[model samples]
Target: MKKNTLFVFALFIFYFSFCLTTVAQTRSREDYEKLGHVVWEVDTKEKIVAITFDDGPHPVFTPQILYILAKYNAKATFFVAGNKVKRFPSVLERIAKEGHEIANHTYNHIINRNITSSTLHSELEQTDEIIQSIIGYKPTLYRPVGGMHNDLIINTAVKNGKLVILWSWHLDAEDWKNPAASQISRHITKGIRPGNIVLLHDWIGTEYSRTSQTVKGLETTLRFLYQNGYECVTVSELLFRSEIIDQDYFNTFPIE
Candidate 1:
């Protein structure tokens, strides 16, 4: 009887997990926009793309990524964690000095979905304070760690005066896994469109140094954009070029 019951419980858990995945896969971008001031991509026709990096300010990889950006004359956004900022202030300073957008990714890189409101607020506030101390201003953008968020996360971020920035659903380079540079570059350059935000990582924590692969991939991706006549700009620049401030601006377009 005990064995039979355990089998049933396992089946129940599997079913529940499958249902969650199905719902996430089926939800359209329009559905996500209804949640809050969330931005996945800018609605525009200009030949521009926003290349954004997350979990950065690494002393080694961040500078390498910056060097490549400079070589290509491209501007990208960097979403940094507070703990990292404290550890690497000079790297953070260089990111700002090099003319890239610096946004918050939380204090400790927390990704718990059931995080309490107070904890979430502290995470954001602490990161904001750290970033402002270095950059002289609080960032207007916040990306939840692991790209996971909910109503509470969205509401809290909005209350704190930030737009929850996410990448184009199709532009995730998945470099954290240490994929080859060629695969990373192709995933971004293929089917590339205007106002698309490309997600890359300049830091993947001390456990691994996968960003070494990312440094190679970035140059190839930038070269493809340059040759294709696409300007690589910051996320804020992309938003301004699209002129989309209203939260409902996404509703005007058909679901992709």
Candidate 2:
């Protein structure tokens, strides 16, 4: 009788531990769904990545950047700030005219954590209005400043009929602080993978001289990605890949 009681207690403990582990795994999956950011990482297999430029449409740098992209037959996504668009309407038009995808980076580039709902809405709406006025259509994608967003931000964007675009990898070029061109290039070459959304800036100040270094680095980075079988694409294309992944996940799970 004593032996049977001890055996039962041990089995109970083991069952409880298994239950806990299962619950933890389920919770992790739920958390990942909630975050819903970084739909893919660039790798050799998928052979596609996105180069995204933020905080732009400045007078000096944007044109030069566009020129370089055109030279390379590369298309990129530009998440322009609303204030900058208002200040440089022609620049925004030129970006749209040049065949690059334009996205919202908010009217003021407000950090989601520090902003209220009304403020967030205002930022998005005002920027959308300005961009639509310039481009004749509002962008359906919004990338929050610094790629920092919460549930509220995502929900707000969805309600406004926009998708929140977040990056999968960061090069940390720190162009604002003037990191060396070699350093920036190295970071990108080493970090790039398939399905990656790389964050870069086209404008740092009024001069736009910083872009010269970035452009040089881009040449090297592009060569590396191309050699490794990675194709550069726009944000819309990358998002489409992510949607396919989501559908696969749902099909596999088949939630009942």
lDDT of each: 0.84, 0.71
Deviating ranges (above 4 Å) for candidate 1: 1-28, 34-36, 205-211, 246-256
For residues 136-162, what per-residue lDDT tens digits would candidate 1 score against the true structure?
999988898888866667667777778
lDDT value, residue 3 of candidate 1: 100
Q: What are the models' TM-scores?
A: 0.83, 0.75
What CA root-mean-square deviation does each model show from the true structure? 6.0, 10.6
| Clash pairs, model 1 backbone | none
Model 2 CA deviation exceeding 4 Å by range: 1-44, 207-212, 245-256
- The sequence of per-residue lDDT tens digits that candidate 2 reaches over residues 1-256 is 9999999999999999986664312223235344453232423357677888888877877887777677666778999999989899999899888888999899987764545557788888999999999889998778878766555555566666666676764655665555776776788878776677787787676643445566566677776776777777788767676553333322232111
Give candidate 1's total backbone clashes: 0
